[model samples]
Target: SHIIDVIECKTFEDLLATTQPLEEYLANAGCLRPLRRLEDKNLLVDDILMFQVLHRVRGPFERFRDGLRTLGVLDKIKGHPESFRPLLCWSPTMLTADLVDSLFTINLSPVGSNRRHAEEVGTQKLGTILAFATGANTVPPIGFFPQPSIEFLHQEQDTATPSKLPIANTCINCLKLPLHTSYRAFQENMDFALGNTHGFGMVKFLIVSHY
Candidate 1:
């Protein structure tokens, strides 16, 4: 039967509603073979179950699982399951002052006006924005921001038009912002762009401003 059909079945519904062990039920129904295969590859079954139960099976999760199954890494993972634990059970690291300082590389020269703007708003304000956007202020998942470092750029040339919004180059995990009229406007724009879901997809390296 299809996985969706199995999930929507009366037996599955009864299993969910009852105090019966889900694992046992699945095992009895021969539904746990795939899960066992994943476990054999050292994948965290609990985490997968949690993700399916809470967020449903997302595209990324499906792709990841499919990749694992297709790659034939069962023997490799079986040999060193412990090595994968750190990755599976990763603890979220909160954004700190030192981390903020180390996270971004300012592309502008020290004497440049753009550099001064970056220095003024990039350090503290950018950190705040990143923290908020990535949920670094609270407990965030490991997938929140995969890349630790970001390239900060202030391309004044790109801002020839005053109406142009900031540009985020996701390919290189670079945040290139156009010159704004004021600090407040810059902050507001950053907040709006980073915080909004439709602004940029999956902010892997914090605020990814785009035109």
Candidate 2:
């Protein structure tokens, strides 16, 4: 099967640098010539790189968090890290309404779905993820669907330790705390979603297809 999409949550530049492996694979496999020839002839057959995140909840949030920490996301957030915007994130529960709307509108459909299944599932989360990751946002509102099937990690309170630099949210690529924003702001929101207990890495790529 052809590569439909690639959700490179490992920052845009990093992915570009890292795609050498994929490029090497294509070169070694002798597929690049045909693909490039087709491209030169205006015959597109693969995905257009779109920035987004896809999160899949498998066993538990803790498992996901640990996995992300291992993948260096936690470290990135702690320092002056560049962005590694993901196309989707899978969690056990749904996100807030505003965040959901920002990621995906309500009307978009799934990428591969039968009439019965589409009717039953509408725009399932996985379908939405695939659509956005593959640049399927042909209209004003992009993204597939929102599936809040799992439980959101409850917010935890941590002592206010003032910092000089801005704090970033790992899940949302561009989100950063304003310079003037106080640590209390973190307690109000960040501490809960992006605190020590619940890290952004907790919500990264996981092999899951929403139903």
Candidate 3:
């Protein structure tokens, strides 16, 4: 009933009031017993619910919660509740650019003399495009991208198809662009892959590949 009440809450204030008892319990018991109770009922607390909880009980809980969800461990945790600790107990670092950068492998042409220059330009452009979509300072949250440890490959020009567009593998977050071709074409294809909101009419397109 309390979980239902939390889900039905229309506003942050209402949710806060409803979760007050849980907060008190957390303070006294030193664990999130009320939240763990969801596991007994086979109910999963999602991002919105967790966000509301985080507002009152701040820490690295979101990171823990999201990591579990990303790893498909929510169901496992529900089955093995005793094996897991309360989200409040975790204090992992929030996602950062360095952390995200470590996940990606940028591959450029080995023989091309302008490989380094192309890499720099292409990487800068990608960052700029992401910033434009997310409105974040250069590096946005890892959630904005489709996945981690994405491979960036340079697309070479083929004589059969000289005007091929950039390809974005959203499933794996791999981006293949003509980084070895003309700068103008490369920029155009890059914009087409991640930007360029020409035919959407009224709806503003953020990340093109995402849509």
Number of the top candidate by lDDT? 3
C-alpha-based local distance difference test score of model 1:
0.51
Candidate 3 lDDT over 83-109, as tens digits, reads: 676652575778999999998987776
- The CA root-mean-square deviation of candidate 3, after full C-alpha superposition on the true structure, stands at 22.3
Give the alpha-carbon lDDT of every model: 0.51, 0.37, 0.52
lDDT of 1 by residue, 1-211 (tens): 2234334434534434431345574554334543322223223234335545654546777787667766676556667889877766777789999999898885655665876766676455555454533435333555444453444345457655343344454443445554676988877766765555333454433333444
lDDT of 3 at 82: 68
Off by over 4 Å in 2: 1-5, 31-211
TM-score of every prediction relative to native: 0.24, 0.13, 0.23
Model 3, C-alpha of 85: deviation from truth (Å)? 44
lDDT at position 15, candidate 2: 36
Off by over 4 Å in 3: 1-159, 197-211
Give the Å shift of residue 45 in candidate 3.
81
Model 2, range 1-211, lDDT digits (tens) per residue?
1233223323545434444456665454343433322232122122221111122233465686687698787677556334443323333656798878798755534645675566655334333332222323233254323321222223246724333222333223223332334657644443332222223333232101100
Q: Model 1 TM-score?
A: 0.24
The best-first sequence of candidates by TM-score reads 1, 3, 2
Query: Which candidate do you rate higher for TM-score, 1 or 3?
Result: 1
